[model samples]
Target: MDTGGGMNEHWQGVAEGLRDDTALLLAVQAEYRRLYERCFRDDPAVNHRLPVITHAFRRLGRWRVFLLLTPWMLARLLVPDEPPDIEIPADWRPAARRGAPYTMIGPAFSLELLTGRQKAHLNYSTAIGHYFLHPLVLAMAPFPTPEAVFGAWNDVIAARNANLEKMRRQNPQQEEISRREFFSGGFRK
Candidate 1:
């Protein structure tokens, strides 16, 4: 799908990727396969396996940055800056909410489409999700609506917050120290 000058911007590096069989993409794809297997470890009674799905992001053109930041700014306005005052049982353990599945990965960002979650930020993210969800077919695709992705992502954030709470309890004194540091402009360079 060339768009005048060359390949469509959305599929820009893909031909090169396919031609060279990028080792990193291959490795990322393989690791996802393992995680996909783990997600269904309890389903030994079923002989069939789930299909892997792949997707690509639609091109954003000149409106990309505006599209990205508008929601972030709006969300910041809607959500207060102050932290919430809530309490949880000291012995409570984190549990997955019904039908909410997640995996923890180190944050990824890439300036170039060939690397990082920035690749997804700039392109159709179904390719990225395909590895995690293990869909059987991967076709040229577009990024889904932000609500579709981030709404579900709230679950992962909740899990992270629970773990952070546990850490705060374990090291209660550090909480005040960190708070003071933040309020006093002690950001690390």
Candidate 2:
């Protein structure tokens, strides 16, 4: 099914946008780090929150970046944006058909043609990535204002990292079990 001329350009634009967004996210993180270092030296609470904020920022940043980028990659391989238009036979008339009309469904996204298993796999991966990244962005955000955005960002990262590290150190055995489980099924479950 033909997706028309706009498909390629649309996906290309999306890919570029994703790349730009990723860069912006990284830059924002760097700025947050610099500010944290310069300003929050003596405060124990701020120190405690640093890793959390960074981890959260990285997580959300990574997922959004992936979400924005994956479509382009899949579009390149499976759909090619300009697929040949399907031609209906001259004698074929929908009203004359005995059964339901022949429905010609074109590609909405690259994954549409994939097997159920493959679609599930891709969806699972996307979900996992999003889960990791969304919180980071959320933590970093200074909601409802332009002034304390950076501060909010830093606070979230610091908090996330601090908790993450503590969890890591506190539960080595659990972590090992989780690692095993995670790898055993590609974390699909």
Candidate 3:
């Protein structure tokens, strides 16, 4: 349980986790930037929401909690992490215990996405990464504008992807796929 003294520290850890999870950062930021530019940029109150989101993100474990949804088989996160142990943010309001007439509404932020009219869509993996993990990273980072988020993560992902793509082809064992002699389908040589 968080006693408030470590709230900032808890979020800082989450921030670090996000930075280290390169695949997660890469997948989430691409889609997030597209959506922000297409959908939310026009909203007059977006600037105001940044702080609320930042605050909410720190509470939401800087998205480390949500990053667990990464596909175990395919994603193969480079910096895999056990979920960070952290308290839920204070802002989550629960329904009244058993008998209250009126319960306080929780903090609600309305986000619009995938409006059902678009042909292009986010895949399952990217969807999870975007909706669950992207916000917290955006919140915790020092981006002064929503668009800034794209450039920051974009450069990192591009560099890392380029490096990883090279790594896939170059085997350190110096092995090669050579022609086999007796392994033909039904014909032995």
Which one wins on TM-score?
A: 2
Query: With candidate 2 superimposed using the best TM-score fit, by how many Å does residue 146's alpha carbon deviate from the native?
Result: 5.5
Residue-level lDDT of model 2, residues 71-169, one tens digit each, is: 001111121122222332222222222243322122222122322211211110110110111112323222333224445556866999999999988
User: CA RMSD for every model?
Assistant: 18.5, 17.3, 18.4
Q: After superposition, how far is residue 139 of candidate 3 from its true place, in Å?
A: 6.3
Order of candidate numbers by lDDT, starting with the best = 3, 2, 1
**Deviating ranges (above 4 Å) for candidate 3:** 1-141, 172-189
Candidate 3 C-alpha lDDT tens digits along 9-90: 3221222324544544554555345445655567553443332112111222232322211111001111113222233233
Give per-residue CA lDDT, model 1, range 1-189, as digits (tens). 111222222221222232222432443345345544766445443222332222232222211111111111111001101111222112211221113344332122233221222321111122221111111112212214444433444665688999999998999999799889988989766
lDDT at position 73, candidate 3: 8
RMSD of 2: 17.3
lDDT of each: 0.30, 0.31, 0.31
Cα lDDT, model 3, residue 96: 21
lDDT of 2: 0.31
Residue range with the least summed lDDT across 10 consecutive positions in model 3? 69-78
The residue-level lDDT of candidate 1 at 3 comes to: 12
Instruction: TM-score for candidate 1, please give it.
Output: 0.24
